[model samples]
Target: MGTGNTNWKKDFDKAVALHKKAINGDKQAAQKAYETLKNIKFQVNNHSLVEAYFGSSSALIARDSTDLTDKTNYAKRGMKALDQAIKLDGNNVEIRMLRGNVAYRLPEVYFKRTKTAIEDFQYLIKAFEGNNRDISKEQYYEILLKLGASYKTVGNSQRAEETWNKLLSLNNSKYKTLVEKAKSTGGE
Candidate 1:
């Protein structure tokens, strides 16, 4: 697919905004967003298209449905979409974060993929370490927090502590308290 569209960025941003709203529990809005994303006829770059699929999948998962099977199916679809996104852009921090967050939240009964989350976070950590300037300060802090949490989830308390310590050293004003709290609690 050609990546020539100048408006793709705007469309991608709009879809992401709707996806965020859906994630925050707006079922109707999520459905609408999913529809809009799905209906986009223009060919976008793989990265943008992957994000659109991810957004659609998120909306599906966020949609209210009473059936357990339906919920599971939706989640599975989302995971598949995320997997595709990751495959499309293996080093994309945003794609990795999306999969990491989804895997981290999955229940043990539903194929808990916490290890996958840890792997993704670690990849991000390594990438950031190699080139800190590749991402913004806010993004760096967010990755550190997620990496720490993922480490803790995988029972690597020492690594988690180390990661949290690094986060504290960053002195991110917005998340300093959060990092301190997590650190104080040993990344519980």
Candidate 2:
């Protein structure tokens, strides 16, 4: 379905921008990004990146939906896409990030996504050890912060403490205030 000689690269960039806006709370951007990413997915020959963006857009739609049915349905669709994306390219950092972020937010009782979140975050932490360029230092910082919370959510307090300690050791100046508060309150 790569018809009309679609400039998929441009579409991908545009949709990614829209997805970022959607993440920042723009409903219209979410809708447009979802549609564009969904369309680009079918048009692209390779699915790894396309599917990741589509999955992220699906999560956005789920987050913005008012109806519980729509919300759950979209979330399920997004999870499937994320699984497929990871299967296509397990080492892709952005895919892992998207999936981890979505899984971390899902209700564990209903979605059973906590383990997936943990796995993805762990993979990301390992990925950070090398020449990984798919994500940024800030993103890694956020990942460390959330990884600790996620461990706590699953009752793994020791792992949580280790993760938070790792984050604290980073001593990122941009997150100084947050780091100070976290230090005082143990990032709970």
Candidate 3:
């Protein structure tokens, strides 16, 4: 058996940083980072590819293009990249979350992918419930909350209430107020 090194930590971290910057509203930084990252032809593994695709998608969304056609093209490119990433790593919670986040934000006339986002959140919940060691407590909580919100977005108030109640049972004091507010609004 041959042992080959396949460490993607550095590239993955850099991509994550860029994605965070994009999420934080620094479109220029994200565009630059995405361009730089995209030029790197080799990925050590599926995880690296997932991050690269996600970063690229974020950059596309962040890029400032005055023309509506240009903006739509960028979004289409981003969605395709994300879809490729998902195909490569279907069970990766982070990848699913990233796609779901983007899909959830897109307008109904454009993408109407809220159902996909809901499915991703539900998948994450099932993975967590299955005692998947890869998930952290924080990730679990975030997924739960997002799941509830997604339910509400689709007008499933009953399901949303049920999901929120499950989150409340987690007993995390820090999120009590937020959960209470969400519950009070019937998961709105």
**Which candidate has the highest lDDT of all?**
2
Residue-by-residue lDDT tens digits, candidate 3, 86-140: 7777788777767776666665457666687788788877888999877788888
lDDT of 1 by residue, 1-188 (tens): 54576665566567678777877887776676666555453455455354535544552554466788877776777677777777777777777767876776665346567787778877777877788566666777877887787677667889888888888887767777887676676453
Query: Lowest lDDT 10-mer window, candidate 3?
Result: 1-10
Candidates in order have lDDT scores of 0.68, 0.84, 0.67
Where does candidate 3 clash, by residue pair?
A: none
Q: Would you estimate the TM-scores of all the predictions?
A: 0.73, 0.87, 0.74
Which residue window of length 10 is worst by lDDT in model 1?
39-48
Whose lDDT is higher: candidate 2's or candidate 3's? 2
**Quick one: ranking by lDDT, best first?**
2, 1, 3
In candidate 1, which residue ranges exceed 4 Å CA deviation?
2-13, 40-48, 51-56, 63-66, 132-134, 173-176, 183-188
Model 2 quality (TM-score): 0.87
